[model samples]
Target: MIGQTFNQNRPLSQSLDTQGLKTKTRSFWVPLSIFFVITALSITVLGPQTQSIFDTREHIVQLQQDNRVLVDKKNKLTSIDKSLLTRQARIAVSAIPVESSGLAALATVRNKAFSSNITINQLRVSEGESSEKDAAKEVRLQFEISGSLSDLLKFIDSLSKAAPLLRIASVKMVGDGVTISTDLEMKTFWAELPVSLPPLNTPLNQVNKKDQDLLGQMNNLKAESLGFVAPASASARENPFAPY
Candidate 1:
């Protein structure tokens, strides 16, 4: 009887052991399945979203750089425009008139000669032919003036400060003892009537160093008083429909 009871207890113990193993296995499988599902969701849903966020950030940075470059360019253009409106710029522009004639240049030379106490014996005017290189028409003045050497030198110096800039093409001088007779061939320039100004956005042409130096020299000279007359205003009847 004792032996049979021992055998019965052994079977019960074996059954309990089997049930404990099943419970442990079920707990392990449940946690493992949850971990796999979370990993899959992260790969499928979150991966592309992260990449898109990075791409958007890069685009924003590029746009910021472009905006900065545009701002700098705008500032530079504003500074240049301000410089264009200065007094020196206006004087430089006025040095070359839009339209002029030989008569005005001749008057300037005569005035300078009178100032220097020189006598102009003859005055001849001729028109220069225009070419592709020099689009503006040139006026050539051939004249003879009589004065002392000192007076002649003064007259030439004064010409440089006169308006409607003149170029001494040739000069011949003869002296007897004190008084000298000088023949001069000079040229001045003029644009045709109805001149149009360049557009504001136009780029400036390249200027040579020599030309820049000459302009600087001209700026140092005293301003000549050229009595300019304003053109008469058109009558309202002339263009009744035009804006005031």
Candidate 2:
């Protein structure tokens, strides 16, 4: 029975083989069509949009450059702040004496001026004579400094940035180089000044100064801020006695 079945299917196989070639078709057309469609959509939609962005290439480059410059400036400013904070930490800020006026900050300035290879021959200072009764009062001062040109410029620049607000009103330069002389009149400010102490009926310093409250406060301020350590909180450190 198996031999007869094999013999019968032989002709059928031969016939199918001859007809199969006629029905055979390639399968690449569907994928090829999809590829064309995708390419067309990208060129018509996404391609033009991307090309527009390229048109602004010059502007984008300039903006990037500007941003980099600004970042550099920011870094420089940050470095300056850190340097100032470090210096302030090393040297405590003392309250200037209210009476002598400009004695504290001015001394610091004058010392710096002298050390900066500058010779200061003449120095003058005048504390303001405003009444302690005045609400808006400042302990004004006048200074005339003679020094080398470079050293004087550096001194002026430092004082401007330093705390307590040292200001220069006038500067006169006489010569150049090693023989240079710069005369500067400078001023520092104090918001309130203490009143001049008067003759007391009782022993001195016993009675409270009711009238010259600002003056007394100014004296205390000078004492406290004159190279005194800031409180722990101001120092950005934890106070040991602070409540837990």
Candidate 3:
């Protein structure tokens, strides 16, 4: 009965209608399409430039990993460092011992003269602590030499070249030939400089010996002159040239 009533009330074409319908468009939809188009264009235009920047950054990092500063640049960097730490450490270690080595130095000096066939007379050794202005204690010597000019010259060269260090203060000479007589006053430095020096003509030899023996003599004579009774303390302070 319901099916008959529906068929009667409505036309059969309307009940099964497939007709087109009118539609309304909103303003937001148009703007939204334009926004998506602008977004796509920006990504397309900016993509390569952004990727190029990233690639450049990666190149720099890879180069840094593969490369090192040149030797000249490294030296310059070392020079720019303000500490001078290695130099100061060397000075402190090798330098501090020169103070008490005057006696051994006198022995070595006289030996140099003797080896050169020169005669040393009126040898004298003296030592003094540094004044407030000097910042370094100094040990000094004065003596006379009678020898050929060549021997005298050689002696000077030898002292300047001596290990454990020596410095000349003044020189006086008379006679030009083989019979010349010269007077010299010289200075040396040590961390624990000698107070009073031993007499000259000691048997210390600098030319040949065990390194330890040479150092031992130097150290012993230094201690004797400076009146330092302690050895353990000194041993603890690093040797300046120790395997550097």
Tell me, by TM-score, which candidate is best: 1
Q: Enumerate residue pairs that collide in model 1.
A: none
Clash numbers, per candidate: 0, 8, 5
The residue-by-residue lDDT of candidate 3 on 97-210, one tens digit each, is 543767656666866776688888888878866777535667788899888888889888876655345678889899966688999998867664446744332222222357
When sorted by TM-score, best at the front, the candidate numbers are 1, 3, 2
Clashing pairs in 2: 93-227, 94-225, 94-226, 94-227, 95-222, 95-225, 95-226, 194-215
Best candidate according to lDDT = 1
lDDT of each: 0.76, 0.58, 0.64
Candidate 2 per-residue lDDT, tens place, 1-244, comes to 9999999999999999878755553365678789899899899988997888887797788777777766666665556657654443323222332234466655556556665766666666676554665433344444556665676778777666554445677777777566666767766654434456543222223223562463333333312134454566554447857766
Q: Which is superior by TM-score, 1 or 3?
A: 1
TM-score of each: 0.52, 0.35, 0.40
- Clashing pairs for model 3 are 96-191, 98-190, 99-190, 99-193, 99-194
lDDT of 1 by residue, 1-244 (tens): 9999999899899999999999878978978899888888779878888888899999999877777766665566666646533654545444554565577677788878889999999999998877865466788899999999999999998887766667799999999969999999988777643457454334444345886676676565443455566989887587778877
| Ten-residue region with minimum lDDT total, candidate 2 | 199-208
Model 3 scores a TM of 0.40
